[model samples]
Target: MIDRDALQGHLQQLLEADRFKDYGPNGLQVEGKREIHKVVTGVTASLALIDAAIAAGADAIVVHHGLFWRGQDGRVTGWMKQRLAQLIRHDINLFAYHLPLDAHATLGNNAQWGQQLGLVADARFGDQDLGFIGPVPDGLDLPRLSELVKRKLGRAPVVVPGDGRPLKRAAWCSGGAQGYFEGAIAAGVDVFLTGEISEPQAHYARETGVAFLACGHHASERYGVQAVGRHLEVNLGLQHAFLDIDNPA
Candidate 1:
């Protein structure tokens, strides 16, 4: 069994909430019973995942993406109504960590991807503090790496080559970050990978001479939430299970 306060506190300490400027507040939201046993972790707090958690008899659901966005209204209606209605009915607690998970050196999406694809490169691009951007491992080109990413992430990448050069330097943010065009260019990364893209990304890829790949946002982010769940199960002696709610993007 896990105490809610203790678990939240441990996560706070480990995730370093103060160090990250996150899209959502880190730590527990929608508090429930003070004592917990079964924990369900997932990428997003979508309806499917929440339903699974309730069915699994989970006291709490930990996720990378939680309910409520930056500009969303406080009113509970429509899709939001259904989601909150289900959770409140079940008395299930929701906990989310966004940027903290992305920035975690050992357990983050960017860092884990960095280990698999790129060698260590000091953990940052420049003044930007959101995610990892660096070089691919030795002697590999873009096409081959794209193949690997397709295999691992189970999706074909939408590649846009800028320099038409083989890739070594690259930047990555697991989810939708088509907005980071300037950051990747400034980092000197020859390529960039993200889940979603816009028209401007195409223009930037052409102009900046940086290769771009859209590899599906949900696919790329699945890793971090699962890793953190397993870590919690091992280190904190909590019963944890990861529920996969597949999304194409």
Candidate 2:
């Protein structure tokens, strides 16, 4: 068992959560048991995930997406109230690490995802250093790279092929970061991969001759939380389990 404060402090230091200005608060979002023995990690703190964690007898939940975004309504009501009620009633702590989780040098969303797809991440540039620029392994063209992405991520990414050329340098930012494609293009990457695509990204890819791939946001982000959970089990000696809820988007 570990003290909640101790766990939070360790996580804050491990993730360097204070370095980035994220939309939602990092670390403990709600107070729960003072001591924790088991943790459940997931991509988001949705009602289903919360219910699953409570059912699994978790003392705390570690998630990539937490509540209380900067622009969201401040009042607790509706779905927010229901979610909070479950946590408070069960006395389960909610720990969320957003941009910090994504930007970590290792065990981060971008790093993990890039590694899984065989991309060697050499640099981080773009907003808050959340974007990763790297080189796709040689001999992997656009078609082959798309194939690898779909097979590894278990979702067919929407590919906007550019120039029909072999992809070399690539940049990726997991989860709803299509806006950073311009930055990737400026970085001279042959392709940009992110979760969630906007209408304008298609045009940007075509105009700039940079390929675009929209892998599922949830699919892309599912790794960092799990990696952190595994690290917790090893580093903190806490029991950890990753709860994956399917999200088609």
Candidate 3:
């Protein structure tokens, strides 16, 4: 077992959580037990994840996404109340890292995704360095790259081909970052990839000739939380398990 305060401190330092302007609070959204034995890490802090963690006898749940977004109503009623009540009743400490988790140099979602795709990250630009730009190795085209993405992420990407050219450079941001496409285009990358796609992005891809790939948000972001969990296991001597709650968005 580990002290909750110590763990939270280490996580804050490890992630530099205070450096980013996030949509919600970054740590300890729900207070639970003082001692944490086993930790359950997942993409989002859904009720199902909480129940699963409780079933696994975990004292804490760590996640990338958590309750209480910026625009959400402050009232604790209905579904929010139920979710919070469950956590309070079970005494599961809820720790969430938002933009910090996505921008970490080594353990961030974009970095992990880049590593998996064999892209050597050369630079990070766009919002708070959330967007990653890197080289695509020789002989990789849109179709071949899409296949590789499918093989690695276990989900076929929503692909929009551009310019009918060999892809040389690419940029990406994991988890619903289609808004960064313009920045990637401005960076002169051959392709821009993100987790989700909007209606307007399709037109941009065609007009700007920058290939766009909508990799599954959940699939793309699975690595960061797991990476943090593994770090806790190896460095902090804590038991960790990753629970992947399937999200099709």
TM-score per candidate, chains pooled: 0.93, 0.98, 0.98
Please list the C-alpha lDDT of all candidates, in the order they appear. 0.81, 0.92, 0.91
- Give the per-residue lDDT digits (tens) of candidate 3, residues 77-172: 988888899899999999999898898989988888888888877998898999999999888888889999999999999998977777888999
Candidate 3: 10-residue stretch with minimal lDDT: 160-169
Displacement of residue 97 (Cα, Å) in model 3 is 0.5
**Positional deviation of residue 40's Cα in model 2 after best superposition, in angstroms:** 0.4
Per-residue lDDT value at 174 in model 3: 94
**lDDT score, candidate 1, position 180:** 77
Cα lDDT of model 1 overall?
0.81
Candidate 2 versus truth, CA RMSD in Å, comes to 0.8
- Candidate numbers sorted by TM-score from highest down: 2, 3, 1
Each model's RMSD to truth, in Å?
Answer: 1.7, 0.8, 0.9
lDDT (C-alpha) at residue 61 in model 3: 91
Tens digit of per-residue lDDT, candidate 1, span 60-171: 9988898866877689888889988888888888999888887787788777655655445465753346657665777778788888888888889888878787676778
TM value for model 3: 0.98
On lDDT, the candidate that comes out on top is: 2
> For residues 1-249, what per-residue lDDT tens digits would candidate 2 score against the true structure?
999999999999999998888888999999999999999999999999999999999999999999878888689899999999999999999999999999988899988888889876888889888999888888998888888989999989999997776687999999999999998989999999999999999999999899999998999999999899999999889999999999999
- Residue 206 miss distance in model 2 (angstroms): 1.0
